[model samples]
Target chain A: MNEERELAINPIVQTSVQHNTQVVSNIRNLTASLFGVAAGTLGLESYPGFIFYLIGTFIVSGLVFVFRAEGKPSEYFHRPLGDLWGGDVFSGLSSFVLTWTLFYGLVRA
Target chain B: MFSSPDRRLQIADSQIRRFTDSQIISMRHKNEANIIPSVYSTHEHTTTTPNSPLPLDITLELLASILLLSTGIVLTSQPLKPIQWSRWSGKMSREGRHGTGRWTREGEEVLSEGDPYAFLGLDGGGEGRRGFFDVRGKRREYAEWVKGEPGSK
Candidate 1:
């Protein structure tokens, strides 16, 4: 009761609580991208042969950073952290299309 | 304690106006408090709530696709299909822009990258659908639960 009374009278404690929640939200977002990279690496060796496989590794790492940007606050995800896994879905889908078109055009021709 | 009649009347009117103004301010404050509670409650629901977007089976399909793309394997025999990425890209681009300035060979590769859903965990190929990648049961379940609310219909 005393603590509540003090907090009600003190603006500083209320501000601190708000800031702490925002900080925790930020941490949750940062941790999510680490998961993104691990998920990205699941089928990496499925590419053609040697060179594409290395390319795959690089792609996954890059994805870790690229997708991390999406984990921040936005109207869509609407949290302190952006949606890293969601961004991975997007990047992966695009990567798939581009690879299929170029590979098909080159090999088939 | 006798003031002039006109003075007394003026004081009474002034006090009445002050009381009305405070009442209006209090009403506004109450409305604001109500809105704050509702917003907080909704936020609590989304982040803390544990609902899955796609059905468990479908989510497994989605995660398989993500896993494949993550592994850097593309199913070459298949034709390219554009999913909901264009919409996602629009939102992502607004934050830190991707693939700007000069496009390197590596950048080109990244741009023309394979399906991320394959890696994240979605199946993208079928007679009526497509497989993104492949996964077993436990890994599939873990991936689906971890990924965001899938926007696929």
Candidate 2:
């Protein structure tokens, strides 16, 4: 297959890939919770709160791209689009909602 | 564990600002409660009424804290290694066990684990190869060491 040939020519290190993925997910999860706190403090409700999360993720992605990936994502991630941008975007949702509700109650109360 | 000093400072600064901002908000809330004594008595009515918008200072502090926290998190995240096999191995070898030239002490420590070729240093291997062995010199040194031993007498 064409994919097999491409892989043969340009081999990937499994360990390095796992490490990079773990690092990205860790950052996403931590920052997602932080965004929840900010959104709750700002008194955002429903749709606006989710939108705030998207924007926050975008900023974190940009920061990782520039600072962590050193402006060349291809070197660090096999599939930069999925791994760096889209990956784990939703994984942080649970934690985000948890903190969002908790802080929303505290700040609004 | 291997965070930069700048990242630590930023996190500390943001936390302090966040604490102060929360304190200010709580104080303002207490003052409001004192002014409108009846409002506190009717908790359900107070809950029903929509809260006022956050003050400019609190909003600014929230934004500042988010920026500082995100920056610190990004900087503190583990540095990614090259994913390509050739590049990854090349980096490992080039950096070596201690990461002599490029990496800092902490970075070297973090990265020195699981080196594929590290075992080459064991037993008469790599640097201890027979080709480069000084047999005469080693024998002489071993003889001197044996002679100097306390039990030898």
Candidate 3:
């Protein structure tokens, strides 16, 4: 109680930005690759290929919030909750596309 | 056939038989040593790490070939990094910016390399109390961590 009072930091909404950022980026990259693999296997075309990844990323974000984060966005994320969950939506698109195209070519051929 | 030395002749014949048996046994050991080396040499090949691009399909399909080629570059290439470096306490003695430069610990802070007390966060100024950059004793900490590697913090 005294330590919290001395620093004047919010105990409820306290988390490290660096740690969250690393986690978010790591999740995005891995899911992007996985989404790409999925897209390729499903034989999804141009727009749908991209859409699949977007949806998958959202699902991953939800999983992170519910299971990994234990439904505590404010505690796990230093930035705005929306920013943490929604900000890096498109960050993994390139990797997803790379894998997606590769898979599609492989499966279709 | 000479009866007086018949025992000596029989002994000589036994000695010859023993010598032949020893020779045959020695030859067999030499052959085994040569054969064993060849058998082991075939299995002494180096093993490769099996992170092959195409693990799903065994057949050489067109899609698999194309995808393998396409992903080979992307998979091997290093991920993109927006910032090359975070620049924590970097020496900026380039051009005309001698002695004075900026150092970043928690955030950016203007610093003179020679100002030991102020640079190292031991200054008795009001900024010390406020912890403007919050880089208290970072210089010494960095110095200790670096082990004199010149700007490792």
Best by TM-score: 2
For candidate 2, give the docking quality class from DockQ.
medium
Candidate 1 chain A worst ten-residue window by lDDT: A35-44
- Point out the higher-scoring one by TM-score: 2 or 3: 2
TM-score of chain B of each: 0.18, 0.38, 0.17
Candidate 3 local lDDT, residue B151: 59
Which TM-score value belongs to model 2? Answer: 0.65
lDDT of 3 at B141: 84
Tens-place lDDT per residue, model 2, B47-115, is 565554444444554566576667667876779989988888888767766632456656653345456
The pairs that clash in candidate 3 are: A105-B63, A106-B63, A106-B64
Report how far off residue B123 is in candidate 3 (Å). 24
Ranking by TM-score: 2, 3, 1
The backbone clash count of each candidate, in order, is 51, 0, 3
Per-candidate interface C-alpha RMSD?
Answer: 22.9, 5.1, 14.6
Native contacts recovered by model 2: 0.80
What are the lDDT figures for the candidates, one per model?
Answer: 0.35, 0.72, 0.48
Off by over 4 Å in 3: A1-15, B1-153
After superposition, the stretches of candidate 2 with alpha carbons farther than 4 Å from their true spots are B1-51, B99-111, B114-153
Per-model TM-score versus the true fold:
0.16, 0.65, 0.38
